[model samples]
Target: MSKEQVVVARKKKKKVKIFPIVNVILFLVISLIIMVPIWKVIVDSFDAKAGYGMNFLPQTFTLGGYSSILSRVALYRPFLISVVVTIAGTFIGLLLATLGAYVLIQWEMPGRNFFAYMLLFTMIFDGGMIPKYLVMKDLHLLNTLWSVILPLSINVYNLVLMRNFFEGVPESLFEAAEIDGCSPMGTFFKIVLPLSKAALASIGLMYAVQFWNDYTNFKIYINKNELFNFQMKLRNMVMDNDIPDEGGIDPNTIANAAVIVAILPFAIIYPFCQKYFVQGVNVGAVKE
Candidate 1:
């Protein structure tokens, strides 16, 4: 190679190394930014002496916060309600997404495009709050868990993702199932579902997280305190200073503990689903 070209190539390699180093530094900074508040919350949750400030570690560490929250019927009841709603909503959401996506993949189905477009249209627009409220009231679902569960379960984005993943599946396998005298439901259960675990896990995780974290629906539709979910309770505790006075523990500590409890389920669940989540997102975004 010419001397100038060799020197230029060396300079380009040096520039490429700088880019990766910059990216690493950038990501580390971003990670630190996100983790700092989380770390503060964790520290404060255990800090009996926790107050209004940035605390890296607890001055007086205690489980008083968790004990106070967990011991209360008010907190636990809402938590149980959240758990039930999350599980039910996730199941129903996955079922609808899978069934709808499977149907959309059937080339010969009548009005397939129409149905797909209708779902897509929802992604673009929604009936305003008054209309939705009236519909829920008419259905007699207001002030009930179903009011929250049913609305969050119908996610068009998840449906579209599942459809994309289904489209990527080999047509030959479906044809083979048909030739073996398998019904549509049989093929879905035996052939399609077995292969779409990644999509299911990813989409199901999304549904679970959505249902678990939802407060607005519960707040708007459910006036009765008994029907409130964990997120709603957490919102009340954090925003409205509604923490029950117990053990003389700091309300800040209890609030932080409640926050941790609210997020704990998903944090424990995500690591196990991480691989499938990544794979599912990639596959669902791309078509063959």
Candidate 2:
């Protein structure tokens, strides 16, 4: 080959390398834009310097924000209530979603298509707040945690995603289970459920996050402060701008602390389920 051709190939390789480096730099810049704000909040929560404006880093690392929140005996009850509601709601919701998805994917099930359409219909439309409130009142679920749990137990979108995952499971396995005289329940528990960890993790994480962040239903149905969840309490604190502290701690610090506390569960949970969550999203997107 000529020296000119060899030099041209070298230039092409250098260009290719430069393109990837540029892309990497761009991605890094975008990631920092997103992450810096979050890190700022976390740092400011522990910052002891009394101020209202943003500090790029912790001005003075102290537990004043955390202490202000922890000192309030009132905060614990709401925290506990939120934990219970999130755990119970996520479990029950996952159970119902799994069963519903399994049933929808069954080819022999009569009226499955109609039922699926009905579920989709509910997704597209919902009765207004007044009507839902009236229904809850009639059911005697008002002023109770079940008021929140029952209404959001099974999200139609999550159900459809799970159904798609179930469909992706090989038909041969179901047939083999049937040949062994396994009941539907047995097949689901032993065969389907075990293999559906990716879908379950993704959907369960969705439910957990929803339950954790729920505030509207709690505010509407629950009139009693004692029945309030962490989100409801946090909302009250934010609106009232009253952190129960005699010490002159910065309110911004308290607010930032509350924000971190509110999202901590999700931050901890997502990393563990991230692999499954991504896999579930991709697999569920494929057309059956």
Candidate 3:
């Protein structure tokens, strides 16, 4: 090779080597940005003497923070109630959203445009809180767990997202199923549902997280303390400034423990759905 050709070869090699090094550095910086705050919280939860300042790691490690939060049986009841509500709500919400989306996506359905418009209208405008409260009261759902679950069971945005996914399914599959004498319901369950797991997983996680974090509905409709969700209990604890103990454990420590305890379940559950969740949301990236 000539001198110019040799230099060009060296330039290409240098470019290839530089790209990976730059990528690694960028990735490390982004990872630290995301992980540091979470790590700080984890460490602070374990630190018994975690005062006003945040710590990089546990200073005086102890279970005092956790013990303080857990010692109150009040917190435990709300935790269990929240768990039941989250599971039940997630299931019910996902079912309704999937079914409703499936119905709406059918091009032949009568009044489809009108119904779709109404669903979209709900996304923008809702009956204010008092009207919703009255509706709940009139339905005799007051002070019941169903009050929380039933009122917000179907999210319009999630329904629309699922519809987008359903619309992307090949029309030929539906035609094939119909030729085999499959009913609409059978087609939904056998073909559409089976092929739509990614969309379902993504929407289900969104509903689950919303139900888990919800406190406003419970606060408005539920007066009974026993029916309060975990977030409600945590709010009471934080707002009332009533730390469980006075002897040694600091209030901030207990607060940190409550934060971790509240967050732990979602963190544990997210990993199982992480693989499908990303791909599901990106189902129709390039719409033609």
lDDT per residue, candidate 3, 147-187, as tens digits? Answer: 99987787998888888888888888989999999999999
- Which structure among the candidates has the greatest lDDT? 1
* Candidate 1 deviant stretches above 4 angstroms: 1-9, 246-248, 284-288
Candidate 3 lDDT at 46 equals 88
**After superposition, candidate 2 runs with Cα above 4 Å error:** 1-30, 246-248, 284-288
Better of 2 and 3 by TM-score: 2
Mark the 10 consecutive residues where model 1 has the least summed lDDT. 279-288
For residue 187, model 3's alpha carbon misses the true position, in angstroms, by: 0.5
Best candidate, TM-score = 1
**How many backbone clashes does every candidate have?**
0, 0, 0
Q: What would the TM-score be for candidate 3 when compared with the true structure?
A: 0.86
Instruction: Please write out the lDDT profile of model 2 over residues 34-79, one tens digit for every residue.
Output: 9988888898888766466667778777787887777788889999
Q: To one decimal, what is the Cα RMSD in angstroms of model 2 from the true structure?
A: 2.9
* Deviating ranges (above 4 Å) for candidate 3: 1-37, 285-288
* True-vs-predicted CA distance for residue 34, candidate 1, Å: 1.3
Candidate 2 versus the native: TM-score? 0.88
User: What is the C-alpha lDDT profile of model 1 across 161-234, one tens digit per residue?
Assistant: 99999888888888999999999999999988988999999999999999999988987899998888888888
